[model samples]
Target: MTKWLLPESLADILPAEARRIEELRRKLLDLYRVYGFELVMPPLVEYLESLLTGHGHDLSLRTNKLVDQLSGRTLGVRADMTPQVARIDAHLLNREGVTRLCYCGSVLHAKPMGLLSDRELLQIGAEIFGHAGVEADIQVIELALESVRLAGVEHARLDLNHPGVSRAIIEADPALARNAEDVADLLSTKDVTGLRAFASETPLQAGSLDALIALTQLYGGGEVLQRAREVLPQLPQVGQALADLEQLAGFLSDYEVSFDFADVRSGYGYHSGIVFAIYADGWHDTLVRGGRYDGVGTAFGRARPATGFSLDLRALAGGLAPAEPAKAVRAPWGCDPALSAALRALRAQGIIVVQVLPGQQQSLDEFVFDRELVCEQGQWKVRAIQ
Candidate 1:
């Protein structure tokens, strides 16, 4: 293989795509800032234990591990940044009330999430810590929806789910609880056939089995919540989960919202409350995923209610149209101080300016020179290319 070749599922981002991703990152961080969210940038790697704290097996599986040279301890390239942010809120910031934080950084996945996904992702997100109410979930959901809207995504759909419902049913039966991981995997895939096969193979209580099967069919419009309350076992947690979903849906009248009871795969399993994903037509999978992951901070010695959402900026940009080449003022190679000053002035004004180097042709994929700086009457001036 060529030395410049990247590994499978990893590739260098070229100029046009990189520019689009950068623009999206700036727009999103600015939006988060306008909502009182303070930007925080965590490191790309951390001690394995600290990085994996409060996350589930899925996150661990995605994390790329290595040995630290100095400390001689195991370190991990982060597959997600939510847990790191939680630790910051718990131990570093140590705030007492509601705290809003946003972050944008590169996260490396051990494996591609999908056939077309990359191992490297520019993850950008915002989180609210120290608020347990569904109101916090509502705010986070709204921010997530607005994120895609700002990206010019049309007809985005919000799908909501609560792990509490599935957890309650799974725990109500000893047999199912013993194999929680398998059961969760089955549910997340919404494999009713596999669930029934597992139910038959394992000695699940009739009520739990019925509820589990009911969940597979409990995905649809707003009415799914009501149908869930009627069809599923009347457990306290299930009732509370349904009520939370109802309340969340009620507040989101402007956007299209739906429910998916069997989608218990709340990203990294730290999600302890209402979970959500934003889906649009252009993207093959979810554009954004997040929810309330209360108590995740406890691993860092301070438990706080938290709700947030994150999306891969690269993936989001990949779905959109290619970025247009930036209009630039092309200047010829020269030692004149006036030409240098003119280039600086235009660049300082945020205009794209490309200075041609001596003895070389200028080739750019991201810039199109529509104007040029030339000496006119002993002064450098910009004139439109004819």
Candidate 2:
């Protein structure tokens, strides 16, 4: 018999781990529910046309393509969920001023084999449609931070950056956009020497190059915002982006929060405005990242304002510390029928009621119960139980 082995980057989640992860996800999703973000479940596979409409060519290339036997046309395993949600908002939810959506599902992509990164990644996220204002941005960021806090990270930092910073530099010299692919690689690898070589050959002005180089190092807390402002001058767009982040920082100052205003970039090219990444204790990588993609819905029909964030559930599960097991309740033997009926009623109200028979009932005091009810004289006496 052949051995059963999961493919690379795919895993079989054990029961305990899966249960804990699901419990954590439920807690976070409940928090989202309180904020009015209705949950949605999008199909895992969609037509390539709908999925790849607004996605740039680079993203389309990485998509895993297939033929649909039923329709005799091309279909694609959804590489990401954001575009699919956008498509839904365009076609299904036609009437909208503002919509809040949350989703948790697996997404497939064409990744090199034997790599640790999953071809199928689990994403738990929310998106806001038809709200273009900065308020929407603030709401999304705050909700994302709340999810991180709920996941047991006592101290977490949210780093915010704007794509406009880099876009402005590229627009100043169109040639830079052509060579952006190489530049992105350099920046990702933090290859300053290679970036300098590329900038030397490109048509970008000296001041812009200096600013871009400075951005590569301007990372950290509020101080980084000052450094970025000093280095990148005469760029109104960058200044406005910095101002927006500062305003957000001021707004969230009361919470256990720290801000970073650096020229951060993301893998997705569609991000047009603010982008952010979340870091917490004991994690090797950022647990979540997302940004504003304003033009995302335009290709479908009319464009609508949008911003959202998604958490890498796998990364979150890896970083979460083990939680103590809940104390078990023991059912007492020889329970009276009337007492059992009352116990059932208590359970219906979500009360953890346990019957203590002729054996030791003293142990019940040590356990955590909101109230202790005892059946006496054909009636129940409720006593406050700590």
Candidate 3:
């Protein structure tokens, strides 16, 4: 019995949390549908080979693997929905037209048990496959910001980065690219000392190195992009990424959404361009993260430009208002046919009807405030509590 205790990181989301999450998921998915994204729900369990191949190294390792009981084959619980969606696009939705997909489900991964970051986390996200150009990227960002607003998340900050900028710098200097992980870590820490030392040893372009260092300080609403534009003027690819970002911002302007340019943090290395993470006030982790992965589609032999974003449903639920708890009701212990008939009528109306016994707490004061009922006047009249 002691060995059967549940793990630490895993938790059961009670009614309130579950209900709140359901509402948010519905709202977000509805928004996705309005924007032309068709909903796609991939199987929760898939062969390890199929699931692992499409994902980045970092994410692949986090997947929880197990042997299937039915077939004695290696299987994995999805770590994230994006890759599963990618595989679906490659294998099933191979049509030339764009395929937009929305998903909401629990993803299982390895983690300390019984914790908040347990093996299971709920995710809600959208993926746009086969669409190309900066316009697609802009649509993803705009939709993300709009969803954040719909969730009632004020003070949400959208941070944008171009994985391509880093890629470009890498192309100009393969040595630096090989050490990209080191550079990414140092930049995230704003380690000026380490950056200067690394730059001195690497044969990276002096101008690009300088811009990279200055980018660490570039954060805030749109102005950060302006600053980045001025700093890396000589780098055409970097400039184009910035311009694309500006276009994305412009589309979001109608919604009065703001963003910050986060050139320093290069997250999700596989992200080819326009990587983004959204942070709401009082939240410690990103509420959503995604980007354009043009190369991902091509990796499957289908060349297409695509972009999408996914929301961390658990995080969003924590930040949103608590769901109103289900009202508790008690069944009456009366033998009167008239009272019983009245109770049945109330129940049919979706009302929680409770009957009080001889000694049990029957007064309206005993139950939750939201719990109310219609009273029968013992074959005289019917009344409802105020």
Winner by lDDT: 1
Clashing pairs in 2: none
Full candidate order by lDDT, most accurate first: 1, 2, 3
Residue range 1-386, candidate 2, lDDT tens digits: 54787666667766556767788779888998999998989998888988887666655766889999999889888777888888778777875689898988888767632244666677799999988777888899899988988888778877777777766766676676777656665665566788788877776765767756776786677777777777776678878878877786677676544444333445536787788778877877677787888878887886878899997676687677764443323444455786677667767877556666675555432344455675567776566645
| TM-score ranking of the models | 1, 3, 2
Model 1 weakest 10-residue run by lDDT:
262-271
Q: lDDT tens digits, residues 79-133, model 1?
A: 9999899999999999999999999999999999879889999999999998888
lDDT by candidate, in order shown:
0.89, 0.73, 0.71
The TM-scores of all predictions, comma-separated, are 0.97, 0.80, 0.81
Residues 1-386 of candidate 3: C-alpha lDDT, one tens digit per residue: 67756776677776667777788888988998999988888999898877765455556667888999999999988887777788778777887777888888888767632234556778888888877776777788788988989988887777777766655665566767778767766766777788789978877765657766775676677777777767753567877777777877776675444444334342436677678888888666677888887756555666566788887788787877666655554555767687678678767988666666678753453234344444444452333335
- The ten-residue window of minimal lDDT in model 3 covers 259-268
- Candidate 1 wrong stretches, greater than 4 Å: 267-269
lDDT of 3 at 282: 66
